[model samples]
Target: MVGVMDDNRLYAIGEVARRTGLSVSAIRFYSDEGVVPPVEVTAGGHRLYDVHAIARLEFVSTLRELDAGLEDIRRLLAGGLTLTELATAHLSRLDDQVRRIRSRQAVLRTIARQHTEAEQVVLLHKLAGMSDEDRDRLMDDFWSEISEGLQVSPDFLGLMRNGPLVLPDEPSAEQLEAWIELADLLRNADFRREVREALRETFSGPGAAMMTSSKMVAAFERGGVIMGRAQEAQRAGTPADSPLGREIADAYTAYLGEIAETPDSPAFREKLAADVLDIERLHLESLEEYKTSTDPYTRYQSLVAIIDGSARQAAEFMPFAWLSAALKASVSP
Candidate 1:
């Protein structure tokens, strides 16, 4: 049976505890702490609580259940803080706690999936602790190191400055894994050397110099026209040996010849093919390695574009490779 409420009612400590579902000792403790001080003391030394005191103790119980600190509860009782203000502050703290818990859960999930050793677990935790700024700086440092002394254009430098491996604020398991692999790749001496070599190959040579020259911009525009035609042909399923394919191939070969400062001859075509093929091999190898480190299903389109456009110009040369092979074969003695 519930205790009856009355404005003038005064209850013994035990009776108050029974009504409020708080332990008698808890009520006494709160009274002693002046959190919910008793209204009076009986002649027998028993604490007696009035209706107001009972209500205050009940409110304190609710706050304690909500994990409110003792000092905060005391401040509220002392009229130093409003309940609304304290609740809002506590809610914010709870939200922060929830975010921290979720982050830990995400890190633990990653560790479990990886079946990491102790050392690896420690490293993963360290990686997870990195702030967004830290990650961005790390990526920038990697790019700066590889690009040291390279004659990159402003446009190209901008593309490289904004790198591909951006981890989301709340990253998924796969994204975290990608980040881990990417970090390893960035730290790799061999990978750095490979990137440096690719940069040199990309920005050097007569062809590279021609591409950068303002005088040769018109030449590049002409080459773009040929590339557009080749793409159309490719979409139309035209074979590389077809007359249309041969025409596009010839136009492409002439463009390369002009860039390389060579006459349009079978010998020059062969030499150009050799140079491009080597760089193409290196680019393909690097792309494959990067692909292995990331989620294949989730493409990093921007990063891919940067790598293809700046490092290899794979988009430009993939069709060119097919065309070059056909042109070389046709001009063979």
Candidate 2:
């Protein structure tokens, strides 16, 4: 035990070691490094620490174990590291390190389970670098590029313009597989041509453009109204065939027919029909291509299947169908 003098100065190095759980040599080394200078020396020439020095020494040991450099620890002990700025910088660095470690861990787990090759490591790294938004943007650009020059309706274009991919933060193996497959498919020229052709079909007829736009709007609005009414009807126990219900239904059907027709012109109509057939064939070809391609990554197959099912259903049941019926009812004897 280093002696404690009567003036209340902290005793020699041994006392600091017992209190800080650091070795006496470590305390002396830090002092020599100017990390935590000793407060004073005794008559026998033993180094002594004040209460403040002892506390600072303990802080040095803690910081060092956390991978802080000795220089940084020295700055901290010397009161040069302003709490706000220095801490903020360190915290950011720590967060980045943590994320990198986690990403590596995830890749290692994949390799262990799947026995993947070197190429898989590169792929995993690429994926780790991609944010959800970035991934979606890549897919959107791919679809838009391939689908260009096809006369798709504004509604379909709008749908495409909105992100088509839906990868979650913690994506599943299936989802990751789907993303890779989708990316590969987007690069295929034949696939692109097919998608373009199919999309052109809806824009082939006279007034096709006008019809598509109007139908899209009418369908969306009518659907919302129908849902509200359906809820009300369900609550009131009223049959959906009531006068109010029929009016809503009829209006919806009529709108559909209005968009599907153009001002009469037999020659133009014939040309339009031909264009439509070509577009349909092209689009169908793309789908056929998908069928023949190596089974898409599971993620992509699931994503496309879900998106396609919902989209096709919406197109078929668009409220414009009801509008068409209303227009027909008004004209009949």
Candidate 3:
């Protein structure tokens, strides 16, 4: 039997466990796996480890705490890999885990705020899983459905095709909610029908598909002049029935006359007033309904689309309720 206190000063498994703060079984397992093997064995079969083995076992404990796999740790202890290389690879894995955890946290925060039912939760999770291209395709599909057969300019069509309400990567709670609301709005059958009907009316109206790029520019320039005059009159507190209001109405009437291919006369002014009121009614019934709906996200989208379309087509002529009122007050007997 070897002497208990040898010249090399080896420790038994119990002493190694006590010194390293590792369990006795863990020390035995590592010793048996040749990870931190004992230097010598006593005649009674006691495993006696060299002092250097304690340092190796302690290192293994640290790597285990860092979530290094047992096989990798075994390989590391077998001198097949460098510590720096293992640390760098483990760091990369940790970074990926962190990203996944953060993504899950963002989703949880979004779901928490929604107070959503089971199906809605599932739907939101599905949306969260979508890539940016997938989300864009979803929005494109909705726009295509509504814009089909509409005689809109290419620029206007592009604007509609890329409407706002894009989902951000790693979106915040509010952005996620906005995406959900926008998706719901797109899925609504009634809203789709309303948009399609509104487009049909717009394409069939007086200033309809006749707006080429040049015509659109001219109309916007003319409309800008009229709007500037109206703004000045408004700032000066001109009454809707004032002669200045009549002048602005006359300018708009001339603009419409150009569009409708009619002479700018009192008769045409009266006819234009009727058409403006009809357009106002249709606007109120369709896009304005979405603008004032409960969903603020969809509401903003609707308002942006309406304003953008009006600006593109220069169809801003007296189509508003207040503008219709002003024109009636100016042109009435």
- Highest lDDT scorer: 1
Q: Model 2 off-target regions past 4 Å?
A: 1-7, 41-45, 65-69, 131-137, 145-151, 164-298, 301-333
The per-residue C-alpha lDDT of model 2 at residue 230 equals: 38
Q: Model 1 clash pairs? A: none
Per-residue lDDT for 1-333 in model 2, tens only?
A: 544434466767987888788999898898888888889977887998888788678777887776677876666656788656566777777877766665566566666766878876787666655676776777777666756775656565665444455654444444444444455456567666665555566467687665557467557666557545534544555444456545554543444335556443434334433543464466456555655554333223444654335334333333332332332333332
Give the count of colliding residue pairs in each prediction.
Answer: 0, 15, 0
Better of 1 and 2 by lDDT: 1
**Worst 10 contiguous positions by lDDT, candidate 2:** 318-327
Q: What's the best-to-worst order under lDDT?
A: 1, 3, 2
TM-score of each prediction: 0.54, 0.51, 0.49
Superior by TM-score: candidate 1 or candidate 2: 1
lDDT of 1 by residue, 1-333 (tens): 975788787888888988999999999899888888889998999998888899889999999999998899999888899999899999989876765565566568767777777877776666656676877777777778777887755445554454444454445444555455455556667767777777777787666654555555566568768867866776677776788866876777778777777788777766765665675577577667655544321123324343224323454445555655656665754
Local accuracy of candidate 3 as per-residue lDDT tens digits, 1-333: 323444478888887777788999998888787777888899999998876777789999999889987778888888888888898988888876764565556557766776767777776666655666786777777778887887777665664454544443344444544455556566777777777776677677776666634467567668768767765666566676787777788778778778678886666666666776686577556655664675433464653444235422333433244444457776666
TM-score: model 3 vs. ground truth: 0.49
Off by over 4 Å in 1: 148-152, 160-333
Q: Who wins the TM-score comparison?
A: 1
